[model samples]
Target: MPGIDRVTLTMITDNYVDMLLPDLPNVTRTGLAHHFDPKTECVQGENGIALHVDVRWGRYRYQALFDTGMSHQVLLHNMKVLGLEADEIDHIVLSHGHPDHYGGLEGLLRHRQAPTPVSAHPDAFAPRYLRLASGQVAPYFNYGLTKEAIRDSGGLLVEHTEPLEIGPGLIASGPIPRVEEFEKAPTDLSAPNALLHIRDGKIEPDIVPDDQALVIQVGDDGIVILAGCSHAGIINTIRYAKQITGRDRVVGVFGGFHLGFPGTPRSKTDKTIEALRELNVEVIAPSHCTGMESIMAIGEAFPDQFMLNVTGSKVTLQAGTQPVVDLDVEARQKIGLQ
Candidate 1:
């Protein structure tokens, strides 16, 4: 259980993008100045989440692309705008079976210079449908992310149900256990009318058993958790990460908290903030499906710790130091734009 010296997370695709956001401690934003060049393109926002993670431990380094966002067009475009090369990615980690999270996988695999390892749960490829509260099940939409599609696109699938290490100090959390009573799946997809999935030639309730997260241990600074939609409940995801890694102090938690969808009670948000406070998380960046109201509330609650994570945003966490925000000039220099 050794920790890494540092980890850098870049948002290749998200639901929002604001070039006006100023940098804060540990966070660097790709602002308007980055696109000053007439030929330089700006990143676009979509209804999905994709993160590029770079890890450094001693003399070794590892890179992982977590979730491919909603579309390859947006994902690749954003990556190009951020100066990230697809060939540099060493691994791909799918957080769940949702199309928004895996939509760009095929395209990304095709763009890679070599076959890439994709770590995910077996159930992620299952045919799934949304079950409405009126007892109606929506049509199944696989979004062309079948196992065959991944392989055909030069991706080597590495399916698992238990935590797997992607690199030094980086662990892909398997299916997280549901421990919080209040943090159940969305109301429309809850038991009795749960999300539908085909299994053994029969349609059954899908609790999204494939939902997972990425846990990074940053030296003694504690663990940083990166997630997709957190359909299993962010609190549950965090607790599970802690349980599996045996690390108590949570350095940061980023990604969709899954609290803004319809039917989610306001009390849930309150409880989530309370739970996070109890954990003393140093930084929290909720994005994508983490509804705006919930995001605002969390930011208000943890003004100093909250980070506005959007497309083109990069968060850097180094061992034995507080996260520092880089100004536009410094950010440009770091990206070699100066």
Candidate 2:
């Protein structure tokens, strides 16, 4: 995929809220207020983020709630409930391989009014685990959504083929080469049999090739990157975004952070923050997997720019103007891990 020319980001999801980010203890707002909902407390609340793409690369890209948030992190339930038609929007760019992000794909397939295509890395079905306080356990990384699944779901399965044009300025990550020395999914996660695997002589190493990102060009607004879990290292993904599409003006970020792994080192978190600051991004909305410590350091480094996302948080992007966002207090009560 080539580098995007430009793009903006629009966050869509549930109404619940919480706090893992330590820096913004004062921050009580997150999640988005829906525009399509009834006259309930939702729409009446502040309007969340809506992105405009006058540029080619930064076009239509939306995430529909594909399942109930019962245990799902990012539910496509709202998207399904609205019965929203799958317009000729750009691409269904996913953040990572977690159940919250991939679970929706199943629902999206069942409800689409027209043909839809999804873009992701080849390792979307690899086995992943989380090291909770109790012990190591499985967290949803085994849904088995493969190339075959895409065909079965009634949508086209487009793998991350470099900074390719999903729709004009919207691009996806290809191979995220980690230049930053500190960042790597420290857990014993494995990738699918997709990419090259080799070792010293026997040529044996677990290939985790499913990690990728959604890079949308917001025209004059710069780039809006949506990450899944960032297991492949956020910096590597950003660097790949810059290299693949030849464009690097990251304005904001959205999706799972995967930072607070039980065994993850403090230095890794600090180094990630350092790289993020060096990236000089405009806005940071760390959600899902982004660990608490990671978010705070970022907020400390770039206060006005770094924030958290929950069920009711929303952000809007306009040309030559500051981004507008709203956090719904009532909606915050409704969020939970599905």
Which candidate tops lDDT? 1
Runs in model 2 lying further than 4 Å from the true structure:
1-10, 14-76, 80-90, 126-141, 187-207, 321-338
Model 2 collision count = 50
Per-model TM-score on C-alpha atoms: 0.92, 0.68
lDDT (Cα) of model 1? 0.86
Error of 1 at 207 (Å): 1.3
lDDT tens readout by residue for model 2, 1-338: 33344232333442223323221222322223333335533311111221112233346344422112223213333333333334534356554455555655655565556767776665554544443454444353454455566677677777664555656556666557756667744323333211222224332233345666767655554666766667677778777776765656776676655576556667877787778888876777775556656655555555556555654433454334354333322222223211
lDDT of 2 at 317: 46
Worst 10 residues of 1 by lDDT: 326-335
Model 1 residue 253 CA deviation in Å: 0.4
Worst 10 residues of 2 by lDDT: 43-52
